[model samples]
Target: MRIDSHHHFIDYSEAEYPWIDDNHAAIRRSFFPEELKSVLDTHNMDGSVVVQARESLQETKWLIQLADQNDWIKGVVGWVDLCADDIEQQLQELVQLSPKFKGVRHVLQGESDDRFMLREDFRRGISKLAPLGLTYDILIFEKHLPYAIELVKQFPTTAFVIDHIAKPVIKEQSFAKWNEDIRKIAEYPNVCCKVSGMVTEAHWGQWKAADFAPYLEAVYAAFGADRLMFGSDWPVCTLSGTYSEVYQLVDTFIAQLPAEDQSKIMGETCVKFYGL
Candidate 1:
């Protein structure tokens, strides 16, 4: 099965999603499973792992509800207050709701603290995931790479996938530091990387497929096909280009690998990582 491992479904309401203000007019409206299903079908994708766009247990529950209704949605990477006093209880409650709840993620990219992932409370929360058979999605920018490396090291048995290949700065065509950090993080066998959200990081209007080649090459070199998975980033990706365009970017790159290696990056790796 071909899996879009890291996309989101946003049923936008100002009260529910204050983050989608005038700044993001393109995706200010709702984007539900039905909408994504069309795109997936057009691309001949088998299913997707719907990730959380907002950080709330309410929204996470909402996603579980969506997954419950949509057979095409293979899994969900929802959010919970990992630092909450009753975090283990909260996660247990969520897991009980649906077997599709495959993992957890926080918008670590939006936080000001570079070392936020290493906080004792957060680490304690992450420590609870392995026992529940849930994975953790590391969502952060390039600057947080070192902290992510340290965070992953602390939980050697827990599965962690890096969202958006750490979101390299492709618009400016910068990669030296990001590449180095990615290579370091890929050293850990427990961690994996997603080839998603590249278009948004590039010069949105002017980005060509070639602009992503170097970054893709770097990640492919570091993670290899076995530890890499494909993601479209969907509605956010539409800010720069269509879902097909985003899919094509990664699809074209992975096509270079042997067929078996291509199969792993496209879906098998995600299935194993999230137990989907």
Candidate 2:
């Protein structure tokens, strides 16, 4: 099946997306599965993995409900308080709700670099998830790459999907340290790269398909087709481009590769990584 491994949903009545607020007028409204399915239908995408945007159990439950209602939603990578004392209990509660709950994520991109990944409690919390057969979706900017590298190394048994390809800003075209860090993370067999969330990193309003090529090339080189996956980052992606536009970019970018490799990056790898 063709899977958009990374996509988002928003229910303004349910909870607040603090980062978005009124600042992101373009995507301030609700983005439901019905609308998303319309885009998927257009692109011939069979399904998607709805990822978490806020750190709320209620939101996680909401995603599960969405998944249960929509056959086209293949899986859900929701959120829970990784540092909470009852984290294991919380995950147990989540699992009872739906088999589609494939993994968990933290909005680590919003935290300060030094303490985000290496803290004692956080490490303890992450270590707990692996035993539960859960994958962790890592969301961070360039500065957090080292922590990501370290976290994946320390928990070699855990499955990790590095979100947004470490949020590379192709418009700025800044490579320096990010290039080295991504390569290091890719060295771990347990880690996978999700080609999502970059459109907003570019000039936002002026980004073109070509703008993301170098960053894309670097990630493809590091992870190869086997460990790479595609994600739409929908609703959030609207900040830079429409779902069709982002999907088309992925379609065009990998057009020349062997069809089998393209199949891996576009869907097969995600199915394996997220257990969808």
Candidate 3:
């Protein structure tokens, strides 16, 4: 199955997404399943893993409901208060509701500059997830790489996918320090990278497939096709271009690689990583 491993959704009536409210000019409106289905069909995507954008249990349940209603949503990476005292109990309740709830995400990208990831309670809570057969999505910037690497070392068995290639700002063409940190993270066998969120990082209106090739190529070189996966980061990628445009960019790049390597990076890696 061809799975787009990362995508976001919102239901205005179900719950309020405070983050998008501030200043995400292009995506202030609702992003419904119908629109997502159109994109999926256009790109021949069999299904997708609907990821969490808000930090609300209601949003998580809402995504599960969408998955039930839409066959295109093969899986979901929902969110919950990882630091909640009853996190383990909460995950048990969710797993009973739907087997499609494949993993959990904490939007650490929005964390304060302080030691959020290294906190005692957060570490305790994260340690509880792996035994429940749940994976954690790391949505963080380069600064959080040290903490992420530490987490991987602490939980060597926990499966973690690095979302959006660490949200690199490729438009600025900045990579001196970030590249070193990324190389360190790539050393972990259990960690994987999602080749998503590139268009938004590039010169938004002037982005081309070529602009992203170098970055994607670097990831392929560092992690190899077995560990890299293509993700549309839809709604978010819409900020730079259409779903077809983004997919075609990745398609062209992968076409340049060997067929087996192409298959691994384009879809197969996602299947193996997410256990789809």
Candidate 4:
């Protein structure tokens, strides 16, 4: 079954999503599964993994509810306060509601401290995830790549996927450092990467598919098809291009691979990673 490994369903509310600054007008409204399914259906995508857009247990439960209601939603990568002392209990509470709860993520890119993941309380939370059969999604920007490498190295047995390919600074043509860092992290078999969110990092409306070539080539070289997965980063993708446009760039880029390799990057790898 084909899957868009990462995307978010947002019930837009100003208070809940203060991060929706003026530049992000397109995604300020709600984006639900019914509408997403309509788009995915046209692409012959069988299902998707709904990721956390907001960090709230209530939102996590709500996402699980959405998954339970929609058979087309294959899994969920929701958020939990990994730093909280009762994190395991909180995960159990969500699991009690449904096994659709597949993994956890922190907007690690949003954290000011580069090594925030190594903090005592946060490490305590991360230690609880894999033991419960859950994966962790490393969400960060270029500066956090080293910390992410450090984070994944220590958790070698836990399954992890770097979100947005570490949100590389494509706008500035930032490459050499990111290229080297991505290759270093991929040295660990426990880590995979989502080839999503590149458009917004580019020159937005003016981005050409060719602009992604070098960056995509770097990641594909680092992770290869077996450890890479496709993610639309949707609604947010609307900031630069339509869902079709975003999906097309990645789909077209990976089209060069062998059919079996393409199959793993498009869907199968995620199924095995999250055990969906």
Candidate 5:
């Protein structure tokens, strides 16, 4: 199954997404399954995983409802307060909502504490996920990679996928520190990565496909096809470019790989990772 492994649907509001300041006015509105379905069809994507934008249980349930209504949404990576005392109960409630509820994501990048994932409460919550058969999505900036690396080490049996290549500083063409941590994290067999959110990290209006070459080269070498998957990171990515542009950036870059390897990054790896 050809799948867009990472993307989001939002009932956008400034109150819900405080990260959207004046610059993100482009996407200051709702985006639902109907809108995403058209783009998926155009790209020949057989299905997608609708990821959470807001860290709300209500939004997680809403996504589950969308998955119930839309067969094209093959899985969901919803938000849950992983630091909560009742995290296991929260996950249990979501899993009961639908078989499509596949994983959880905490916006670790936004947290001021550099070692937020190391907090006992958060790690305690992470422990509850794998027992219930849910994976964790690592959403962090390049600086948080060491914490993420430590995180995966503690839970070797639990599956984890790094979103947005950990949001590296591609626009500045900086890579040494980011590359080091990325390669280190990739050493863990249970961890995987998404080739998503690159455009937004580049020079928005003028970014060429070539701008991402170095980062791609680093990740492709470190993670290989088996550990990498494709993600559009749409709407937010639309702040810089179109979904088609994002798709083609990744699609064209991997064109030279052995077809089977290409297939794995494009979709198969995602299916197996989340059990979609």
Candidate 6:
């Protein structure tokens, strides 16, 4: 199956999603599974993993409900208060809701503290995951990679996938620092990388496919096809271009690999990583 491992479904309610502001006006409205079905069909994708955009357990529950209703939504990477005192109980309740509730993610990108993932409480929470057969999605900027490397090292068995290749600064054509940090993180066998969200990071309107080549080449070399997967980032990707445009960019890049390796990057690796 061809799976887009990292995309989101948003039902825009101000009370439920206070995070949406005028700044993100481009995607301020709701984005449901129906809206995405056509795009997925057009791209010849079989299914997708709907990732959490909000940090609320309510949002997680909502995503699980969506997954329960839609067969095409193969899995969900939802949010939980990993550091909550009753986190174990919370996870138990979530898992009971649906088998498609596959993994957990926190928006580490918005965090001000660069070393937030290394905090004892957070690490303790992450330590709780492996026993439950859940994976963690690492979402952060290039600056937070060092801490991510440390965080992943502490939990050698817990599966982790770096979202948007850690959101590198492709717009400015900057890569030296991100390239070095990503290479270092890729050294950890437990970690994987997503080739998604590149268009939004580049000069949104003016970016050509060529603008992403160097960054894509760097990640492909560092993670290899086995550890890499494709993610559309969907509604957010629409900020720069259509879902087809983003999908085509990655499809073109991965097409260079042999067919077996291409299949892994497109879907198999994601299935193995998230246990979908």
Using lDDT, give the best candidate's number.
Answer: 5
lDDT of 3 by residue, 1-276 (tens): 677989998665323766665446678778989988887887778888999988889889989999989877888899988888998899999988898888999888788853576777788878887787788899887678888888777888888899988877788776767778788888988889998888888887687667776677778877999999889998988877878888888888888899998888778998888777
- Candidate 6 lDDT tens digits, 1-276: 899998999988777676677756788889999989888998899999999999999899999999999999999999999988888889888888899999999988888888889988888889988889999999998889989989998999999999999988888888999999999999999999999988989887688999999999999999998899999999899888888899889889888889998999999999999888
Task: Give the TM-scores of the predictions, in the order they appear.
Answer: 0.98, 0.97, 0.94, 0.98, 0.98, 0.98
lDDT of 1 by residue, 244-271 (tens): 8888888888888899989998898988
Residue-level lDDT for 157 in candidate 1: 95
Indicate the residue-level lDDT of 182 in model 3.
83
Give the local distance difference test score of model 6. Answer: 0.91
Q: Which segments of model 1 are wrong by more than 4 Å?
A: none
- List of clashing residue pairs for candidate 5: none
Sort by lDDT, top down from the best: 5, 6, 1, 4, 2, 3
Candidate 3 lDDT for residue 76: 85
Model 4 per-residue lDDT tens digits across residues 133-226 = 9999999898888988888878878888999988888888899999989999999999999999999999988888888999999989998888
Please provide, for model 5 over 1-276, each residue's C-alpha lDDT reduced to its tens digit, 9 standing for 90 to 100.
Answer: 899999998888889988888989898888988998999999999999989999898999999999999998999999999888888888898898899999999899988898999999999999998898999999999989988999999999999999999999899988999999999999999999999999999998799988899999999999999999999998889999999999999989899889998899999999999999
lDDT of 2: 0.88
Q: Name the candidate, 1 or 5, with the larger lDDT value.
A: 5
Candidate 6 TM-score to native: 0.98
Local distance difference test, each candidate: 0.91, 0.88, 0.83, 0.90, 0.92, 0.91
Q: Ten-residue segment with the worst summed lDDT in candidate 2? A: 13-22
lDDT of 5 at 198: 94
Look at candidate 6 and tell me the lDDT of residue 253: 88
Superposed by TM-score, candidate 5 places the C-alpha of residue 193 at a distance from the truth, in angstroms, of 0.3
